[model samples]
Target: MKITLEKVHGSMNTFYMVDGEERDDYANLALQLCAKDQGVDGLLVILPSNSAHAKMRVFNRDGSEASMCGNGLRCVARYVCEKEGVDEAVIETMKADLAVRREETLMDGIETYSVQISPVSFQLKDLPMEYDNQTTLIQQAIPEISEEIMFSAVAVPNPHLIGIVPEEIQKSPEHQKKWAEKFNGQNNYFSDGVNVSYVTKVGQGIFVRTYERGVGFTNACGTAMTASALISCMSDMVPFGEVAVYNPGGMVKCTVNKSGDTFELLLTGNATRLSVHEFQWEEEQVDSEFTAFEILDEQRQYEKFIEEISVVVEQFAKRKE
Candidate 1:
């Protein structure tokens, strides 16, 4: 059947958003569409919702259904708001129906949207990580990961492990991958796998690099960044308010509103639509010619936005050095 798949990204964490009827073959569909050849970080299916403006179902490249995806949620926000002729809407996720709103352009010609990242938890039973009798891990050193670095686990609806590491460990992608593999693989530490992020406090903001569950390492992970920001707040590394979260892909702003033990985060970033593909999709395969009319302007504008942030990134790296 002929269908429209919009390629979208928030902070360069990409996904192919399909506004279609809800179906059961999402696992198989994600595995196929998210393959490396014609792939994205994940697949987003937008279905009509009785409880909210729209429903977002996210499937990672590994065909795992995630509880929430803030990046994907922003894309869905833009798509649904544009379709529904509204500036704000509540989109149903696997965990909750999140509030998303259209915002002023974040940069030159780059459309922006802000979505809520919420219902934070640090309880052990909430995460896939298997830790001892502790109810939560808040900046504790887990010897299995690294004796020196402290880790904090949070379920911002999707399980995440955040570590504020020193220069050496933060710069070491191999170091992050090494431990991420152990926990995501055959290890008792994380029986069901976890999204692991290594963060470094930078001169301008905080830098985060995430090794995601199901998707391995991504250019960015919105929920992971939000979790990391909340961790930064919990650790007093950064104040609990508007925090600039930078990843390898790009940067996003996370406003962490803290009231006692409760936390609410607003994630704002570029919801750039790369292109609209005119293609035919079958039940099992891409059965016909798929023409990609690339959006050069959005790509160019986003590149400029990336160029604008390179200074802060450079300053961060230099300060680390």
Candidate 2:
């Protein structure tokens, strides 16, 4: 089947804008191809399945799907509202319902987007942090780190570990690597690997570098930003309300209620359309390549098929002068 998709890039993440209807049919293909091509940090699909409600699918470059992504949804919202000339769009993902609206203008002189994620859930099981809720979590001194690192567990859609790293560790690669390993260890207190943010106070806003699970160090993580803003509020670093979070990729401003429980994330940045491509498949070739009604593990076969197709695409791109 021939598919149409839009390639959009946000601060540090990339995504594919596709029709919501074709999500289940083509999401895996898009994920594998884009990841292999290094075309994006993730995939955001607007499924045509429910045109009334657009679906956003985020897939890591490694082909693993994520619950939610802030940067990606903002970019996709901008594309749909501004480019497509729509006012409000509802983006449904694996996590929760996201309401995104278009901005009049962006700092980069382009359209901007904002998404309303679910209220930050800190309940131990909800956040899925390894710790039990019986024990209260407060700012504590880390073993090696000199300054205090405020670590908190919050989940908008997926889980995240928002930590305030000392400026010393923020600048030291060795320190960053050390904690990254610590954060990744199963003993780190998270059933599923948690996205850890090493944040520093940089003037008016906090600067962040995040080590995300499944996706490794990314420029900006939307959920991480929301979590950080909430953590900052809880720690009294920033006032309760809208706060600015600066990352290497761009800036995301988030608003939290007085209780620091509900969070509204505004990812103010550019979403540039890089390229668009068509998908074409040779049915006869595919059929001939495999035996009719051959027995094979569906999951394993599909994985191998994706890998092989990616190699072909890469080879073709390299062949271009």
TM-score against native, each model: 0.94, 0.76
Best by TM-score: 1
Q: Which stretches of candidate 1 lie over 4 Å from their true place?
A: 36-39, 286-296, 314-321
Query: What lDDT does the true structure give each of the candidates?
Result: 0.84, 0.61
Where is model 1 poorest over a 10-residue stretch in terms of lDDT? 312-321
In candidate 2, stretches whose alpha carbon ends up further than 4 angstroms from where it belongs are 20-27, 49-52, 82-84, 132-138, 141-147, 181-188, 259-266, 280-321
What TM-score does model 1 achieve against the real structure?
Answer: 0.94
Candidate 1 has an lDDT of 0.84
